[model samples]
Target chain A: MDRRDFIRTAAGTGAVLAARPGAFVRDLYAFQETANLSHVEARYYIKLPDREIECQLCPRKCRLGDKERGYCGVRENDGGTYYTLVYGKACARNIDPVEKKPFFHVLPGTAALSIASAGCNVNCKFCQNWEISQVRAEQVTAYDFPPRDVAAAAEANRCPSIAYTYSEPTVFYEYMFDTAVEARRRNIRSLVVTGGLINPEPLEALTKVVDAIKIDLKAFTQAFYKDYVRGDLAPVLEAIKLVARQKIWLEIVYLVIPTLNDEPEEVRKMARWILKEVGPGVPLHFTRFTPMYLIKNLPPTPLSTLRSLRKIALDEGLQYVYTGNIPGDEGENTWCPTCRTLLIRRNGFAVEENAIKGGACPSCRNPVPGIWA
Target chain B: MTESLVVIVRGRGVRSRGGEIAPAVLARIYERGLGLLTGQTGAEEALRTLFAPSDKVGIKINAIAGRELTSPPAVTLPFAGLFSRIGIADRNVVIWDRTNRELRAAGYALNADGPGPRILGTDTAGVGYDAEPFVHRNIASRISAVLTDRVTASVSFAILKDHGLAGVTAGMKNYFGAIHNPNKYHDDHCDPFVAELFDAPPVRTRHRLTVLDALVVQCHRGPAFHAAWAAPAESLIFGTDPVAVDAAGWRLVERLRKEKGLPTLAEEGRPPLYLQTAERLGLGRAAEADIRLLEDEV
Candidate 1:
């Protein structure tokens, strides 16, 4: 049978078996499909002396032998040929509010065609979507959703933007980039909901096509990142800086965990860094963290914690500091940086009233930094 | 720890006219190796020593590299057949790997046959992974239900080969088949992770033996098949101590590499650090002084 039929049959049947925490991460060693995964030659990699290859996709720089996969569990080296297995093979697809992506400043309250393929560079302990995100390309059910089909679906669904989200978009860069190009052709915007752990070359190219990018800052201290995220904070910071510098409407979301990353001192440091790097105007959302994945022992971030962090960020001169995942909290509304008028009134992803006229505050006429159309 | 006895049993002309295993020689190989491992007694007592009659044994095979370089059905099925004849119920034995396609490629008949030892992959329709992840140390993964809920004991029936990154892929590294995220653990020449993973309860508690399929050892440019570098070792290595078994397997690969005038895995700077880590964890002895190696041919 064709892979498409196989996937449908596999997923349609009881094949969607409940997973036990395997001996290690959710790489799905048992879902051994053939080279059904894409062999589209990857962009960032160098040929070694023998028939080996080094993947320069992320910080791992996984120097793989003939048939080994990278740390991301997606890319591979086949006789010195590097390839990404999860190019167009999306595992998760949903119509999500752009606010859920927490792109507070970019086209708020619009529905986005959000999609993700399996695999990620970093393994986050608190990943809510580990069932799909932490698995290998073949482990998760893959569909034949190529670039054009993705764009067509977004247009059909009345979505103004396509968001590469849920899983790390960097693992599926080629597919996301192609879809971004296709979406651009159809006059639909492409937004990247990423952890921002990608290398510079890919990120630079992605910014050229995507309209906006929302980065999950994860944590402030490198130690916290190293311990919890299994990824470095420096590269993520570098990515955010690159996105901000390219003037690609960038936003940052820092999920506020109770004790893990919720230290007021660290929050203040992150806030100060943001002010210095992206300036005060770029939207920053301090999201509430829910206990999930491997971190079930920790309690979810309290409502008061999000409020206090928002206060801290606002105090540090971040103009559009907001509290997320908590509905109808005063921090949900965007106040004009100049006149302090509520420019965008939001109540749980629904735009109550837009007071900005032509991308500017109606009262003060100060330009609000966003895609106002 | 008990005396870790590992026997490398080589069969005369083990590979047939078409490059597949000679079933007669293959059967004798298991018989002879099991005989040595069970104190020169026989295969029946060996099976008893390894598993109880009521034990539902999972024979985890490595079939990722395809037929020639993978743990072939010819080698694995005959071993399971030996266990079945020795009074372990056929229904209690399963010869498995990560996926059906690779199992099929390696000449395994993917079966859910109720009457006999079944040959299957984790992707079998009703079985996938556990709904919740089991976190052990640095590992957080969705384990296959076949392992968690189906099998009572496990055996890593892995292929021995020269790994480009991890120095050598043997019995210990073979448990990579058991986890969802083997890819994540390949960093640092797959050092403490492999050792630590074996220490995890799901593996450390349930594991019973290490059977390395060394008949067509990929001594170089592996765990993938490279005909230029592949050798006909025509042997299988068996041991109760997982670390000693893998450490011994590493030596075999190094021997083959030295024969080929190639750099030792250590010279290449990718010695199996898992052996050292495994030693430190007191999993088993890695240095030669601690191991007792026995060799024979069927």
Candidate 2:
């Protein structure tokens, strides 16, 4: 009981078991006290010549040396100056539900705030957050929460967005690019999430300050990104064609995993390579694999394999295909590829009804592409 | 299929005009390299043929290159004082690594139980890492609860360098500091994730010996500490075939990078192909006709 009094008695017994209602409360103050961490100075790296450096922000350009550390153990190179020890050091904040970052066309049943920090340039043996993405910002227990206090804790938790998310926000890319330029100076919205390994000039400068990135992809063979995602499906299909030629909002997910990446011709060649590279209104999802970390003897995914891989990414035309983690399955909803009309419904990460009036499909007004208001 | 002996030794003046380390010529070069890697002429009968005075041991080391290339407290407290000369207890011999601020930035002196042998780290206080993750093939991690629940005989003791990515970070990549992700096995060049993390079962069922600390051999842009390819090489390699003491510390860091002309971790492409994938996973003998080597000096 001395890691700062076990994180101040597990953050005062997680604020008195987060106000008691079902009370099993265990964020044991998200553990941290691994000597506080955060060293800062990191950004697309370089410095080489003896004390060594390299990093160029992902695609594993690592190169480090003087006290090395970059297969994203939250960056470090120290004597040659690379740094980023989980910059604003959050480790795992919360709020959730931008459809549980199943963005399902962003801003649906909003909330976000998410956060995260440790590390992860891809080690995904089904890492449902490998205790903070396969660890090493001194093996977790963070909480400084910088970047303008993560945009003032997403405007004091009324949170219109600000996710960066559960772990691999591109190895805390300078604390998610300065908490997406301080949650875009107040009107919130920053999203991100990631696994699209990165580095196309820092993911084209994080698609000019985040807003909706997502990208899990996780398997469309390079032999399942070299046997179970140590990483490299061509830099996550060039970070989903650099976040669909940026102006933000791009989704993806995948998960599947039953006999490792639930094949069906690798989900119809990853839905015909995300319908010929990030097109066909990119929403995707599929999601369902439940066997936690290092993939516990495969079992969870099979609600008819996420409805036969969401009918092969919606019969390979891919107009926003869905189906994640099975919650009352009508493949989770969001229809009207042109008047099929359910236009956003969802149940698990709860949205329950949207209807899409102006962003279109109010019974066939047609348009539907994202950030719906 | 038989070979694997190794040994090396050297020691000579064992460094002193202030560079320090001469704990009696590094304890007669770790008692003549554990009496020639255990043929036994008494370094406490070659550590009672690898410990059993109610075992416990540990020693681990390689303090992440801090005080000019780590593993120093006069070379790992005279090899943790040969495990209290075999009856193992100055509190059951610990030593460790993976922070006590890198064993107090390599000069050491932390001693968890207020005694002689315990020099702490695995982050100390209720020692860390190992709340699961032991996995193996393509190695999942979390080890270092001081090598899975405080030693039952281990040793590694690393520090022979030139690694700019495992072409030569000796003694089986020094058990990548006994787990907790050695930067996710420095990809490919740390091949077979440093021989599947020394054939994992927490360092292959509690290792036994290996030693290395090739006295200041950084040999060129190494696991950091450059000082002009830092080469004193007062040696000390030994082995219990942890891939023939890191393939004789990668042929003494390619003979001090071919005496400075450099270029040959396979002509600079990062050649510790995890010692032929730790000898195709049998976990020993990385070529040179399967290692018999030996040497000496002290």
Candidate 3:
């Protein structure tokens, strides 16, 4: 059988998939069926002698031999030149609501033309999209969506912004950067959804193009990053700092697993850090964790756990703290910090109402920080 | 504890500058190596000692480097022919690798049906990785169905080369192709991960032998083929002990590198620590004192 047929058969038997969390059970996305990989030469790599290259894309700095791929599985060192096999080769694409990216602060109530290629820099144990993120470029079926075509598709679909999402966009830096550049030429905004595991130079360059960036800050502790995420927390923290310094919109999402990262002390520490470093205006989302991929043993984060964490962040003097993955919760809506009026009411990925006018609270005229234009 | 036995069989003109491998010379090398490895008087007897007549044998070959540096068809096909001579059906024997494209580039005819030896790849239609991951230490990866489902016994028929990270790629490192996420295990010079992966049930329980293709060894800057560094070793190395065979292969690469006036892999800070890791796991011998070397001429 072909890959498509094999997946279908496996799905019918409930043999291929791990136990998914509740939110994923309600929304099952279909896998694409065309493994059209690209061989475009990558950016942000250092060519070494003897046909080896050091990838400077993420913190891994993977020094690869000729014909060897990096940890990301999408980039390879071919005869001393590093190339991204997923460049402009999108494996997942859809017009998702802007809040699904959890960018409540940017372009609320608008549709985002979201796209992702196969592979990610970090291997998160609880990865929801492991079928795409954990495979090589050739393993997944992908489409050849070039930068110009991506920009055109976003414009044609009436999406106000293009989101580089679903999988980590850092591994597809060249594709995302060029696509953002093309989108800018058409007066369309570009956004990024990432794990923030990129190097400073590339992250700095990317901020100049993308209008907003939603960083999934998995956890605060280095142990959590090393064990669960297979990445370093310092670089992500550094990336958050760098993005906040720029004019681009920045938001952080921390997935609170039940027993892993939901401790009150750690949550308070993270909230205080955000308050000090990134300021209180930046939206901090406490998204619920799901049982997926390698970490299938853990249960979903409890609502009380999420609510308590949100209370701690708000109590720590953060402005726009929100809870995610819980439909019809009051925390899903954005309440103005000054007047306590709901600026944007959201349920799941759908927006019920948006009350902000000219980037300020409609009730008290308090200057709420966002890209509302 | 007995020393692990490794046989090195050589042919004077096994490889030509025109990229042609002498099939007759390769056949002799395979015969001698298998005879010594199994303590058998003949090739067919050696095969009988290693596998049952009802067993489906999978000869997993390394073809990631394409035609330039891979397990040559000239060498592997003759080896498969020996299994057929031992009363194992040709349909029960599979000569396979990771992808069909790599197998085709390595000059293998893609044969899955109406087959003699069932030459194909893991990516062939109706064949893919196992649905669930085989979670070994530091590795959660999907294994190719050819190894997990199709084969009862496995032979790692690998091309020996100087790896930029692992210091040497031989029998043990060749199994990296069997997993879906080898890219994740390359860090720390592939130490412990390679050994740990081999210790996983799918590979450890079924593995029967290791055959190293040393005819055209890439001694420097490989896993990839570089003409200046590629040396025609004109030999095949065989053993039941995966670590000992790879340890022996490392010596060959170091010898070639020394001849070219380059630093040893140890001096370059990239020794194949996985061999020692494998030894610690009680998988096989890695040290010279624990390995018995035997040489023969074809």
Candidate 4:
């Protein structure tokens, strides 16, 4: 077809032409604006001979030649110098509820300045936000929200914390690290909502500046990680261990897909592992998974599955296991583990009530582990 | 049955030391490759057979490696010019890659909407990656607007080079540039990912030809430019089957490595397993017995 005819047809068939189920290419597509990606020299990388460089930031350890990009697609080796293409390049910016970040333990009802850039190290098959995470820096429309500017925007918008969310924060490590440092200076807290797919050194460094981290532990088995997430499960487990060891408030979320990862045995094993590794006090959220991306063949997770997984975690002696994405469910509320009283009554992205004084349950006077100010 | 006959034409003087392809030699290389592949004596006759008059051709080149190692504009533009000569309009032929920056860095002027076969990248204002991903077997990525919207038929005018992960980056792997997330598939020696990405509809459906510019091959430690490892072996690989074209490119790189006493890709632990997977998927044959390689001195 001719260019004019193609555009006319594309425009004419705009809403009717849906991407057929399991089809690889599309008839109608929308090209995003060019994201103004940065090229600043990156940290946590070593220069090698003949302009080659090795990235030590993540486990991938991408050994790149001059002009080649890493697995993250944001970092490139520029004539023996490694540079990050997403330093302070905020591809997405929004003011979301801290509860939306799902930090129920921390400041419950406050707003968080959430931001992220394009690109992720791992490709999750059930990615709800693949438009941002699964694309290169240049494929999105981005703004120049520098570290200092991010802090300023958060403060200006009355957000208590700056959240490195939407996409994987690990991919935009430099931006997150710098932004966290700047937030610390302004007395604003830093929270990272991630899959915990990170190396130790970077995680250690990130924890030093951030107040809390919510790790989305996808499944219990390495097989699930390989088949579904295209990433290793061990590094994520290691990240959780490191955060738990660092005295950081850590929470784990498991999106219960229908048949793929919602097995009771898997949930039980995961609960036991969490109980052993991070202790019984850590909150574990069994989130309901929606059918999206490559895994659209299955339906959304059933309420029964979420409830069953939650029950397993509670039975495993895990103190604070909850179900998410189900509005107004009792699992959305944070009941005091010791006293069995609602500590933080939550519905959707709002905190309805808080029966806590001095960061402890009012009924039992048990100190709850959170950043409640 | 749709018979896809691929050809590889080797030329002696395609590369000049000043980093420009001698256009005369390049035109001859194209003629020889197309003639043998299409069984037509002339370049126009071969291209006319391959492309319908209504087909708007897109020549996608790999230009991320800069001028030292990229599909030179001299080689690709002349081929785009050939499409026009064979009754395809100049406005209909697009010489494109992922971004205009890489094209400019590799010494090509960026011209998307203007005249003369429209040279540009996917990152142009009206042109960018598709908002939704083209979800294929193992690959899910946002493709370039040029491919999804503008072009009717596509040619992979890619540079042949050694990749740290993929073993060799040639015509088949060149479609990585057509997507937004090529970097994500570089793991596991680019096994399954490379083949899967090509099997994706955006690439496989539109892809009509594969042409590798082997004038300056990055023999070792590449997909990036390392002067010490780069070879001056003046050759170009052409084919209709993307699988066979890349396989020929791999053989050329292996030949260069053996001459340099360097370790083979297997010894280095980065073989292009994607070709084998592609073969299994019935895209094309990756085996040596399946390929009919035609070499010429031009």
Best candidate (score: TM-score): 3
List the candidates' TM-scores in order: 0.93, 0.38, 0.94, 0.92
What TM-scores does chain A show, candidate by candidate in order?
0.91, 0.34, 0.91, 0.91
| Shift in Å, residue B265, candidate 3 | 1.0
> Mind giving the per-residue lDDT tens digits that candidate 2 earns over B1-298?
6788988889877985356877888888878888888888858899898889898888887888787778678778777877777787788888887778777776877888887888877766566776667887878887777777878878888888888877788777788887777888887777888888888777888898878887778887878787888888888888888987888788888888898888888888878787887788787778898789989897
Compared with the true structure, what per-residue lDDT tens digits does model 4 show for residues A263-303?
89988988999999999989889888888877889988888
Please state the error at residue B21 of candidate 3 in Å: 2.0
Give the alpha carbon lDDT tens digit for every residue of A1-373 in model 3.
3334433432442322334422221122112112477878999999998889999999999999889999999999888998999888877777678999989988888988888888988888899888778878877656677999888888877788999998899999999999999999998999999999999999999999999999999999999999999899999999999999999999999999989999999999999999999999999999998897888898999999999999999999999999999999999999989988988989898888999998999889999898998
TM-score quality measure for candidate 4: 0.92
- Per-residue lDDT, model 2, residue B86, is 73
What ranking of all candidate models by TM-score puts the best one first? 3, 1, 4, 2
Task: Give per-residue lDDT, candidate 4, residue B58.
Answer: 90
Provide the global lDDT of candidate 2 against the true structure: 0.79
Query: DockQ order of candidates, best first?
Result: 3, 1, 4, 2
Q: Tens digit of lDDT per residue, candidate 3, span B210-275?
A: 999999899998999999999988989999999999999999899999999989999999999999
> Candidate 3's fnat?
0.36
Candidate 4 Cα misplacement greater than 4 A, ranges: A1-34, B1-10
